[model samples]
Target: CSSCKESLEDQCSSINNEDNSTINNLKEKLSLISNFQEINLEKSLTLAAEVGTALLQENDELRQQLHLTKFEKSFSELELEDQLEESSKKIEKLINEAN
Candidate 1:
């Protein structure tokens, strides 16, 4: 009976050692996972900033194009009006000379 008791004590000690090893391995895996997450987070932030800057530059370019289009349209309208006014004056002079 004393020999059986000693064997059981040794088995318990072996089981404890295995358990401690498993716990340590799990802790190391958790630390690695945490570091990986931090690295990914920084990469995500950097990409987002780059995308935001690109979008802002595109918006500014579109705004400039719009302003140029508006100016060109205004200039065209003024030219058409001037041409029409000159034609009307010439027609009035012709009618007066005929009278």
Candidate 2:
């Protein structure tokens, strides 16, 4: 009866040790998961900031391009008007001379 009691005590002790080891492993895994989640969140925020900056830059560039295009169109219209006036004057002079 004493031997049976000793064996049972040893088995219970072994089971307790195994349970402690399993708990320790689970705690370590939880800590690692928390660290990984934090790192991922930081990386996502950084990437979002970078993307926003790039989009703003592109918007500014497009605005400048639109301004330049408008100026070019206005200049062309003025040039065409001047050419038409010169042609009209030349035709009038020719008609007067023929008369």
Candidate 3:
């Protein structure tokens, strides 16, 4: 009977050790998961900031291009008006000479 008690006690102790080992492994896995989540969150935030900055730069470039286009159009209109005035003066001079 004493031997049987000893055998049973040994079995219980072995089971307890296995449970402890499993618990330790689970704790390690949980810690690794927590660390990975933190890293991912940080990277996501950094990427978002970069994307936002790029968008603002693009917007500024587009605004500058628009301003330049408007200036070019206005310059072209002024050139056309000057050409028309010169042509009118030439026509008046030709009429006076013919008369």
Candidate 4:
């Protein structure tokens, strides 16, 4: 009975050692995962900042293009109005000469 008890105690000690080792290994893996997650988060933030800057620049460029288009449209409309007025005046002169 004494030998049986000794055998069970040795087995329990071995199992405890294995459990401690497994626990330590799991902790190390968890630490590595946490480090990787931190690095990924930093990279994601950097990328997001870069994308935001690019979008702002694009928005400014689009706004400038829209302003230029509006100016051109206004200039073209004024030119067309002037040409129409000149043509009407010429028609009036022709009608007066014919009368």
In model 3, pairs of residues that clash are: none
- Residues 20-69, model 4: lDDT tens digits: 56556656655665676366676567655655665565566556556655
**lDDT scores of the candidates, listed in order:** 0.64, 0.64, 0.64, 0.64
Q: Could you tell me how far off, in angstroms, the CA of residue 24 lies in candidate 2 after the best superposition?
A: 47
What TM-score would candidate 4 get against the native?
Answer: 0.60
Put the candidates in TM-score order, highest first: 4, 2, 3, 1
Candidate 2 has a TM-score of 0.58
lDDT score, candidate 1, position 16? 53
Total backbone collisions, model 1? 0
What TM-score fits each model?
A: 0.56, 0.58, 0.57, 0.60
Worst 10 residues of 3 by lDDT: 1-10
Which residue pairs collide in model 4, if any?
A: none
Q: What is the lDDT of residue 4 in candidate 3?
A: 46
List, residue by residue over 20-79, the lDDT tens digit for candidate 1.
Answer: 565566566556665764666765676556556655655665565566557656766887
Candidate 4: segments with Cα more than 4 A from true spot:
1-39
lDDT of 1 at 12: 51
What is the alpha-carbon lDDT for the whole of candidate 2? 0.64
Model 1: lDDT to the true structure: 0.64
